[model samples]
Target: MNIDQAISARHSTREYTTQAVDEEVIVRLIGAATLAPSAMNLQPWRFTVIRDQALLDRISREAKACLLETLAPGAQSERFHALLDDEHFQIFYHAPVLILISAEAPGQSVVEDCALAAQNLMLSACAEGLGTCWIGFAQRYLNTPQGKQALNLPQTWVPVAPIIVGHPKTEPAPVAHQAPQIRWIG
Candidate 1:
């Protein structure tokens, strides 16, 4: 698929089938991620792919508990609270693979670079007829020391994006998006 088609086809896939993604396809997606533009050639991104179901389940539970503990009681917390109330909610949606895009440095640009890499990876997955979703809910817990130990992440690597990839169970409908408000300046 072309870039345009990939971009249009890529969406946040929350549900996936039990089918496993090929290792070669996973490698290709990561290769695409590495090609993303970085600031000053500082390719600070590192990836950790998780395929173990037990680990994924533990991470999901810990992440939800961590989020609940940290959230303040207010309007913003209500949505999260409601989500946590669901007993069967899996943060990664039981995807066959979970890829964490991390950065070695702590800075705004480093974070941006990792995010760019994640976008590239997602698009590549779409082109390969796979589904991908960026799970922000996993971020907070994944950054913690215990979480880092669980994933065997390096001390310097900071988790920036949690993405799940697999074969989609169903195709999502087109999302209605508003046109960007642009101001021309010459």
Candidate 2:
């Protein structure tokens, strides 16, 4: 698919099939991600690919608990608390693959740079007829000591985006987007 098609088709996919994504496809997508521009040419992104179901489940449970324990009591947090509290809430949605775009070193715009790469990866996955969803819930646990150890990531490397990849059971219908409000100053 073309870039425009990919962008139009790309949507956050939560439900996925048991089918596994091929390693070559994963690598190709990551390659696409790496082509993204970075601030000051730092290219401060590292990658960690995880395919272990048991580990993903464990991380999901731990992260949910962490979010709950530290979540401030408020109406805004209620929805999150309810969702995380659900026993069936698997953070990665049991996708066949989880790819983390992390910081290679601490610096400004590192997260932003990694985020750009993630967008590229997701869009590329869409073009390839694969599915990807960035799992924000997994980030908290992934930054923890146990989470770091589980991934064999170094102490300094920071996990930026936890994206799951798999075959989608069904393509999601397009959702309406609010039109952008433009203010031009010439």
Candidate 3:
């Protein structure tokens, strides 16, 4: 698919098929992510691809535990609860590939760079006939000691977000646009 088609078709895929994405496909996805613009051209992002089911389950459990502890018993907590109970939440609908995006600290623009890279990866995945979902809830638990050890992430690197990748089971609905809230000054 072309860039426009990819952008138009791209959406947050919550459900995916169980097929494993090929290693070559993952390489292409990362290549696309690397093309994202960064502050000072400093590519300050690293990705850890998780394919082991045991590790994925552990990460999910740790993340849910941390969420339960940190968030109040309200809407946020309810959402966490639902995520914990979701069959596809941690496993990405049993997709064999989970890419964890991380950034090294001591830099001011790391997070922004990582976000840009993530957007690129998602769009590229859609173009490649793959589905992806950006997961932000994993960061909280990933910062903890147990969570850190579970993923074997370096101390300098912090988990920023995760993307679940696989063949999409269903097509995403198009998003509606809202009125522009911009002011132009000449």
Best by TM-score: 2
Candidate 2, 42-91: lDDT as tens digits: 89999999999998888888899988988899997999999999999898
Q: How do all models score by TM-score? A: 0.96, 0.97, 0.89
For candidate 3, the TM-score is: 0.89
Candidate 2 runs further than 4 Å off: none
* Cα-based lDDT at residue 113, candidate 3: 90
Instruction: Enumerate residue pairs that collide in model 1.
Output: none
Sorted on lDDT, highest at the top, how do the candidates line up? Answer: 2, 1, 3
Q: How far does residue 81 in candidate 2 sit from its true spot (Å)?
A: 1.0
Error of 2 at 92 (Å): 0.5
Superposition error at 11 for model 3 (Å) = 0.6
> Which segments of candidate 3 are over 4 A away from where they belong?
82-91
User: Per-residue error at 35 for model 1, in Å?
Assistant: 0.4
